[model samples]
Target: MFTLIYITASSVDESASIGRKLVEERLAACVNIIPSIRSIYHWEGSMEEDEESALIVKTSHELTPQIIKRVRELHSYDNPCIISIPITGGSRDYLEWLDDEVKRP
Candidate 1:
C-alpha cells in the first residue's frame, strides 16, 4: 500500500526542511514543494487569509503516522495541515520506484 501525504507549511524554507528531513530519514520516497500557496480560512472567530507552501510527500501507507509525527514536531503552525490520501493507482514503474525508495529496514 501507498499514500500521498499532503502538508502545508508557513514558508518555503520550512517546507523544504520538512521535505529534506523526510528524504534523509528514509521516511518518504519523494517530496514536491509548491510555494506561495494562498490559503483562506476561519481562525480565532474571524476569517483570515495567508500564504503558505504545500508539500506533496510520497511514501508507504505504514509510514504515514511517522511522517505526520515528524511534521508536527518540526512545524511552526499550531494546526498544520497533514492529510493523507491513499493512492488508488499510478504508473507501475513509478510506483515500483517509490516502493524501492521508502522501504523500511
Candidate 2:
C-alpha cells in the first residue's frame, strides 16, 4: 500500500530541505512543497497563526515510521505536524514509479 504524508514546516527552505533528505534517503518517493500557506491552530494555551510551508510526501505504507523519524530529526519545530493518509488509488505508471523511487537496495 502507498501513503501520502502531510507535513508542515516553518519555511520553504526547511520544507524543501526535509523533502530532499527524504528523497535522497529513499524514505519518500516524491514530495510536493507548497511555498506559502496560512496556518491557524491552537498551541500550548492559545491560538496561533503563521505562514508555513506544507509538504505532501509520497511513499510506501511500510516506510511511515522511518519517514516520521527522519522528519522529526530534520524539522526545526519542536512539535511539527506530520500526518499520513493512505493512498487508495492513483495512476498505475505513477504508482509504479513511486514504488521504484523508494525501493531499498
Question: Which model scores highest in lDDT?
Answer: 2
Candidate 2, pairs of clashing residues: none
> Per-model C-alpha lDDT, please?
0.93, 0.94
TM-score of 2: 0.95
Question: What value of lDDT does candidate 1 attain over all alpha carbons?
Answer: 0.93
Clashing pairs in 1: none
lDDT score of residue 67 within candidate 2: 89
Local error of candidate 2 at 11, Å?
0.5
lDDT (Cα, tens digit) per residue for candidate 1, span 49-75: 999999999999999889989899989
- Candidate 2, residues 1-105, lDDT tens digits: the string is 999999999999999999999999999999999999999998888999999999999999999989888899999988899999999998999999999999663
Candidate 2 Cα errors over 4 Å, as ranges: none
TM-score to native of every candidate shown = 0.95, 0.95
